[model samples]
Target: MQRILDRLLDIFPAADRSFILLRESHSQKLIPVGVKQRHGEQDPNEELALSQSIIKEVFTNKRSILSVDAMDDDRFSQQASIINLSIRSMMCSPLLVGDELLGLIQVETNESEQQFMPEDLQVLTGLSSQVAIAVKNAQLNEEIEAETARRTSLQRYFSPKFVDMLMSGDVTTALSGKTYLGTILFADIIGFTAMSEAMAPADVLAKLNRYLTIIQKLIYENDGNVDKVNGDGIMAFWGVPHSDKSDEANAVYTALQMQRHLWSFNLDLQAENQPPIHMGIGLNTGDFVAGNIGSEDKIEFTLIGDHVNLASRIEHLSGRNQVLISEATWQPIKHLVSAVQLPPFMVKGKSTPITIYSIRGMESHEQNGYIMALPCHILDENGRHLGRGILTDSTPLSNGLCLRLSTHMEIERETVLTLQVETVEYHQPLVCVVKVNSALKGAHGGGSSYTKVVLTLMQEHNEDMIEFLRPGSCVATNYTWNDLKRR
Candidate 1:
């Protein structure tokens, strides 16, 4: 900053004088642009007076204004606008840092008819860009320092990014209703109720937030959001607020990663004679309602729905330091992970059993896996779905049911599916795909690319797997026939 500012005056021929007008997020008037009486020097900080107006202008137009001669430019010819005894030439460069307009820099001279050269304006313009970036960074560093002080004073309650993002007002995507599939993760400190009973509330909160700081950093690294902190438990998600397909895998991976990180975190805690903490994590993936939920007084930018609830239950059932994931999350990632199966347990309020898996290692998981193929599209090496029907196989087991497994690709195909685990007569949870089968393949096909997928069930829990294909029950990836009629 000093180098650039020095160049503003020294690199170019001297005007009368120049100084930066520093206007922060607030308090625009304290050092208002124009003049400041300092050490018997007149207008030592004249740039302060017009800072408020200049900042406002730069933000509105997103460009700089050069007043080669303010006395001639009608906009500032008024005596009230004259913050200093400026008789002739001046140049103002807007201090812009990225999209934000920090403030303005104006150089003035008392010399009459002394025109400010383009070389002067060019130097100021170039320097102003650098100055803007410096100003923004300085402000950010100040905020970071202040925030660190505040957080340290409060005993580290939230991660730096969480506080910064919220303060920046960029949680629009976190709000509900936008559909995205990603891993939802939950972590709970085992025996927290018992621990809380022994410790004071303030001490408990301090310890809890400290532990969360570690967990949150790990989640942030994996591109996940800390949905919210509810007492002893934490809810978080990946791939929304920023979308990515490996969302579920990332969540599951983070869970495993946290367990490893905590080993060190807990070691430090133990050295301090603090209670060692152990946690359990659960991950699930499905269509979830996302948004800013709650009352007028408060809003929660997080996820909701059965998927979130189910993930919580799985976490509760998971042992200390365990990363348990649901079957829905497992299907797409079974190839990428080696999960030891947990005995199926019925979730609360739900009669069906949810098969859970614990990841042991990644090296073995990638070895014994099937190819990833979507319904109507074929995926290439770059993970982009190119052609269609690439999952062709000889053992096409078409029984009218189509397994709606969301792969890294998005395809609409009528491939052979087994309804061994059925949601609808045609809806299969996990389909052993044999080929890239389709009902429509010509230009005359009735359904568009967005057309609802039709899936026929092949199996049910109580009966033979093939009995589901006997008709009556229909599974669809797109829309029902009744919905088509209305369309």
Candidate 2:
């Protein structure tokens, strides 16, 4: 642009100064990009002011203007800028390319000795066309470069959906350090060191990629972002770059699906005479700091805080093929999932014991409704009747069931119980054997005199009763205690 300005000054010897002003796309304001003055000019670039009326006239009419003396020109004589800045001889041309106005170029002189000619305006018009094309190409190149850099930097941490948002200039403010409520998840392969030691280097790399690929796919499918890879583990989170109401639920969904998908993957290994691999996933929800952190030369977008550390701590406590979560993560999703509350645990960095829950499976919509009161028979593994209770709910995937009893049963944890209930149509018994996962006693002295029992089907036993224990099959039957007892 400065070269163009200097060339224009050389072509028009009468002009003392020339400038190129381009309209900013975002602000729609014209800003000076280049300025060239004849030798011995006293004023700096800031003092170079153009008449608003003349520039506006050129743009509005899509033409050029040549004024021998602007104080005598009817079109701009009344303009305050022309009178205040001193009457002058000037020429203005609209920079345009194929009907689009890019901005304009103007050349003027305050001396009475030099006045622009009609021929000079025609020459300036042709030059403005070439200048418009050059400026447009430069702008497009800048946009492309910026987009490429943004996508490359953000793809290292965020998913593609979020990458699009950041490139579009939305939520770019989130890159700064700020506190945000989010859910963090950590998933690690169990016995990874031992497994790698037993395999070749190429085999280990292949297996690790396959494992991490599955986890990465599931996390993006549930609208979460991968923060970083921690050795054999992956650290991911939701609610940075933007916030979503379903953040916690999405995190839980990703964790559960990751386990299910890995199990399916393990079946292939077992068939090939290779040892099956297992993984442990943990999730926690709380406020954390999200931003780009590191030295001036190297930085990465990641999360940091006590909540982030707690998520990793909880993952360390997870056993093989298990998904565990902090109490904060369970509060909002308890109604949607079936989980077992574990004893309070003492973590390394925390001063108090933290409550944790092991996620079993998702709760089906049919089982999330009000608990129905129907007599159910509980038997031992030998099919011998032990006692009776009220069946409440069943979880999805046919993995677990919930029951309420009148008195606390002396059943030990892990005790297998054969649960039986009659159907409404045929009055035929529907039975499934489940091991006791938990048993809690209510205050027997008060009106709340009931014991809640959570039961889970062992993996070996689930295949035989899956169809019977499936979620939608557990419907409420209209049978009274007398009808149930008579049978």
Candidate 3:
């Protein structure tokens, strides 16, 4: 543009300086973008002194104006800058592409003997037309490049649907930093350390890719944005780029489906003689600030807030193959799903205890129940018979059940226990294997005589356990192991 201005100045006989003014994108006001001066040392401050009245007139008429001795012309004589600059002659032309006025180019002379003629105005107008088209094309190319860069960057964080919304030129306000009522989820593989150690690096990478491929697809299918992926962990959220009423439900459903899909994935691994994979998912819903955050060189569209951290905390609280959700997340979808309320536990950052629920599944036809003092036989992983224990509680909606055994008898944590439980619903006793999660010593109808142990079902037996514990599917008599043997 400066070269164009310089060339124009060279074409005119006595033109002292030339400048181009382009319209501001946001504001229609004109601003100088390019300037060329004859004397190079011309006072920079004196350049803008050109008559605004003449420029406005040319822009308003969409044509060119050549003034001879502007100090005598009544139209610009009252202009203080024109009179003060001692301007003698000037030519202004409007730069237009079709009907859109891009800006204007103005050239002037201070010499009194040199006067701009009608032919000068015609040449300036013709040159301005070409300049307008070139400027428009350059501007369009710049916009296309910017949009392409934006789309590529956004694809890393958002699903395709959301990427389209962001690129559609609508929802401009939502793109800025703002508070959003959204749902955040964090999921990570269980026993990843052991899995990584057991397999070769190549095998681990292939397995990790398979897991993530499934997770990524499910998130996009649910319209959730994947914020970041760190090794075996994934952080995702909904209600960004745009918010929908289904944001919370979609987040929960994504978590649920993720677990459901893992079942098949694990089955595949088992068939291949590979270790079955397990994951823990946690979800929380609340207000968070979402936007592009980083230095100028690198920016990431992610979420930031206490709720986001809380979601991570809840994820760490989840047991293997469990989906844990905060109370806030469970409130809206409480009626649509079945969940087991876990005890309120204190987390790292808060003074008060946070309440969380273990999501079972979508609303179940069976009511949740607790069975007490049912007899069961416990065996070790090798099928060797171990001491018998009493089933104190049946939590089919959660990831585990509670068993009562003698405190003196020690059961190592993570020890697999094969349980042969007799239920009246089926002739054959319902059999399943579970792993000891935790053991709590307590006094139950006696003086600290038993240890209450928490057990989580092995992945292969989870479905069988749920079916066995379903209400009305199992009848638990208050008979202890001793009483049943005596009868």
Highest-scoring model, lDDT? 3
Model 1, span 75-171: residue lDDT tens: 6666554545654676777777777667767676666766787777787788788877877888889999987676554223333554555455544
Better of 2 and 3 by TM-score: 2
User: Judged by lDDT relative to the true structure, which candidate is superior, 2 or 3?
Assistant: 3
State the local distance difference test value for candidate 2: 0.74
Ranking by TM-score: 2, 3, 1
Model 2 CA RMSD to the hidden true structure, in angstroms: 15.5
Worst 10 residues of 2 by lDDT: 440-449
Off by over 4 Å in 2: 1-127, 130-134, 168-176, 241-243, 267-274, 363-487
Top-TM-score candidate index: 2
List the candidates' TM-scores in order.
0.46, 0.55, 0.53
Model 3 spans with C-alpha error above 4 angstroms: 1-19, 24-63, 68-90, 97-101, 107-134, 159-181, 196-214, 227-231, 239-244, 260-277, 286-310, 326-487
Give stretches of model 1 more than 4 Å off: 1-32, 35-177, 200-203, 263-275, 294-299, 349-351, 364-487
Residue 298 error, candidate 3, Å: 8.6
lDDT (10s digit) by residue, model 3, range 235-324: 999987667788777888788778756755664675577888888899999999888776667766778999999999999877555678
